[model samples]
Target: MQNDAFMHVRKMFPDLSSHRHRDMKVSVATEIKWVVFYRATITTRDGNYQHTIGQRKTLSFKDAKIINLQYCMGVCTRQLPCQNSGYTDPRECSECRCPEGYGGTFCENMAESTIPDCGGELNATSTYQTLQMEGDFQAPSGSSCAWRITVSLEGGYRSFYRTLLGRSM
Candidate 1:
């Protein structure tokens, strides 16, 4: 039986490399009645292809005449997860290759960003003004948080300071 299966495979793909070829699964489809289905997995430079051959009548592996055969091709044959939006068509692996701006096993992750000077300072002042800054801030140690506004005196006098308590600043 092994020799017969090997002969069939050799006859189908005479040049199939031993290192590249994976395995052959030969099974009898009893529910189909009198039909034997065998699948051969062959690896190539692009991907893997499953060649399924269905033989009829004789139970002997050597005498079973090939009645139906089909080839299912591509990387998706391995059945990997490919629900992500950024993934393109299958290339040479189980999962489709990601585009330029996408990544991950299924290309579900967006690529890192590259922006210049994302943060800068914007300051304004008037003759008489109320300074207001409001946002979420992380503190180093102080139990109480305060907003401080300092004003320099007209001459060499000391500076004027005011503190507003609570979360707002």
Candidate 2:
């Protein structure tokens, strides 16, 4: 959104720029026009990934947060995804930290992604929160892409998650 934010993000991932452009248009309120644009990049930190959203398109200021998007459905850019990939354009991804029970780029690791959507409570001793994001990712320990996210909390952990759309494997 701001140049300083862009600079800060570019600092984390050198590949990100402050002037990348993408021709993105969305139907917001029944109007089809360029509404967002920008560039984005990701870096591996320890056992997780850290992404920087920047270079917001002046039109929408939400589409220009990624670069070389191989998947486009909500906000990933680039269409004709390679089967089960990034979110479609126009969708904004939130930011959140994954829990121990879940791991992966999108945090959609089944068995670990959710805690049994059937009132299956966890057995931790702290607080529990949800990440600010959603995705249909293929678990690194499983086969086939699963439509899940780093949702829910366990171990009674504290609130350290935000809904952010992202792609992971």
Q: What's the TM-score of every candidate structure? A: 0.20, 0.16
Relative to the true structure, how large is the alpha-carbon lDDT of every model?
0.28, 0.25
Determine the backbone clash count of candidate 2.
32
Can you write out model 2's per-residue Cα lDDT over 25-142, one digit (the tens) per residue?
A: 2112111011112333344453112222333444222233233233433453333221112222334334222222233444343223222221122222223432121332222222
TM-score, candidate number 1: 0.20
Q: Which prediction has the highest lDDT against the true structure?
A: 1
Off by over 4 Å in 2: 1-65, 68-86, 89-123, 126-141, 144-169
Which residue pairs of candidate 1 clash?
A: 133-169
Across 1-169, the per-residue lDDT of candidate 1 in tens digits comes to: 2112111112222111222223422111221111113333443343211112343444432122121111223434464554332333445445554433334677554433222211111122234333232333322222222211222325522211111112222
Q: Ten residues in a row with the worst lDDT in model 2?
A: 7-16
